[model samples]
Target: MTFRLSVERLVRIFPAQGGAAEPTRAVDGVDFVATAGEITALVGPSGCGKSTLLAMIAGLEPCDSGAVRAGAVTVTALSAEKSALWRRAHVGFLFQDAGLVDRMRVIDNVMLPMIYRNAKPRDRRAAAIAALERLGLGNMIERRVDGLSGGERRRVGFARILADPRPLLICDEPSAGLDADNTEEIRKLLQIARADGACIILATHDPELVTVADKVLPMRRGQLVAPDLALRAGAQQAAAAS
Candidate 1:
């Protein structure tokens, strides 16, 4: 299988801000591969550097050492402008916040990224609407983003990323602030994305987020730890019982 994203001994360090100690290693020689059409969950406690690792893969932050490859492209060697372009073309990022424009309508927000790519206006709008429909938000196209509920806003963000049609999707705390029903909806959406050949890397603390994951990597103290088989078996049994 072709790997959609690969991290080889990736390392990132943050310099001390206000006369603190030496540079801290946020990510320390972690390695993983995300294959196309699969969901990889990164789960751990807070301050485990999950978000930092995702940002480095997204080219939003620089790595201190090692390499990140999205398909055949080397992210570490790309210039800032080239990295931005590469991300725009091949990566989609969903943060904890929806990050929508309050003044824009739901569909418009979804179409904005396509606009930056110079896609045809009519085609962009059509694609946005289709994406929203896939997310079960078809009827809310004309509504202002500010008026939507938390779940609805998240669906809109999911639609926006889907409309971008990127191969690699990175989600940070996608289940944050979502109730059970909304969480399931997001989970279903992610499953659909995986079916459509997108490689997903999800960084989240929620145990519910791991239910559908193909592989789970637990991060702790800047290292990627293996998932506990006993815990996983217990979780599977509980899920079956439920």
Candidate 2:
């Protein structure tokens, strides 16, 4: 099934640590639509609320005020239990940290999402193997995740996305901190997902990946802005801090 994402007036505020500091408006009244069969790239400098916004859309973080709609479902309004269930059914998240179980075998880690969605064990195994093989990890399927390098772990995480093929794929810096080859590998994987008609939304600073996007949403200070304006805002903030 195909699903489009609609984000409306999204807001997330973090209170000041002490009485002295001002509150941080992580994502302030952001709105956009990410259509299925295309990729939406959120481009911005670090600490510009890209990750926070993705978290809210994924229902991994609560919104201060706003609504997230995926197809006909009100994502932000679902109960905690229901939200989790809904995510397992519809979302494929590729976290920046390469969220994987270090204690499990590589193949098992890739199979986790399929398990949550109750895929047949035999089919899940096949899909996991195919995904791993595609990412050049077929030989290490039985190896423990903790033994893998950072790049390997990240690739394993991508393999999970390949195995599940969820309608809504939310990726946070999917190609961050990788060599050219690995980054290219990730780009190919993302392209494959787009071709398969997943509504792909990713937070990235990778220009190569940006070139593949169907739409680019540039952000600054938690709000969408023109590309040039976002660059100017980031430069201005840096000069002020200096």
Candidate 3:
């Protein structure tokens, strides 16, 4: 099916942690459409609401207002119980921190999502093994996560998302802190995901990587700058320089 993830007037507010009077308006009534089989890159500097927008879309963070319509499901509007179920069955998220349990074995960590979703115990082991193998982490499956290097652990995080890919992939900087080769690996994995009709909304600062995006939305200080306006502005700069 050709799926589309749509966000309308998404907003998020964070209270001051240090007893400050004003709250932080992390996301300010942002809106956009992300289609299946293509990557929609949220290109911006740090603290520009990219992560905040994604968190609201993924239902991890509460939004003061907005509607998220991904196919038939109303993402941002789900109840707590339904929200967990919705994320497990339809959203394959790669959190910025790679949200892995430090005490678990690498394979077990990769399999945790399925375990939470109540998959057949007998089938999960084999599936986890396959996901690890596909990510070139087959030999390290038995290792504890704490024992692994940063890069190795990051790959394990990737394996977790691919263990059971959903229709939509909400990846937050899936390639951060990687060498050139591993970044390329992430790029290829994204291509494979898109080929299988998964909708990807990636938040990234890498311009070279953003080139693969079907639509690039620039954000700053919690507002989105439309791609059309951004393009025309770029062209004006080029013409003036010439």
Task: Please name the candidate that would achieve the greatest lDDT relative to the true structure.
Answer: 2
Question: By TM-score, how accurate is candidate 3?
Answer: 0.88
Q: For residue 224, give model 2's deviation from the true position in Å.
A: 1.2
TM-scores vs. true structure, each candidate: 0.86, 0.94, 0.88
Off by over 4 Å in 3: 17-21, 227-242
Q: Which candidate number maximizes TM-score?
A: 2
- Greater lDDT among 2 and 3 belongs to 2
**Model 1 over residues 1-242: C-alpha lDDT tens digits?**
56578899999989887898877778999999889999999887778899999899999999889999988899988999999999888888886677799999998899988988999998998899988998788999999999999878888888899887788999988888778877887888899899999999999878888988999888876788667753565577689999
| Ranking according to lDDT, highest score first | 2, 1, 3
- Indicate the TM-score of model 2: 0.94
- Give per-residue CA lDDT, model 2, range 26-96, as digits (tens): 99989999888899999998888999999999999999899999999999999999999999998999998
Candidate 3: worst 10 consecutive residues by lDDT?
226-235
Alpha-carbon local distance difference test for all models:
0.87, 0.91, 0.84
Model 1 local distance difference test score? 0.87
Estimate the Cα RMSD of every predicted model relative to the unseen true structure. Answer: 4.9, 1.9, 3.6
Error of 2 at 14 (Å): 1.0
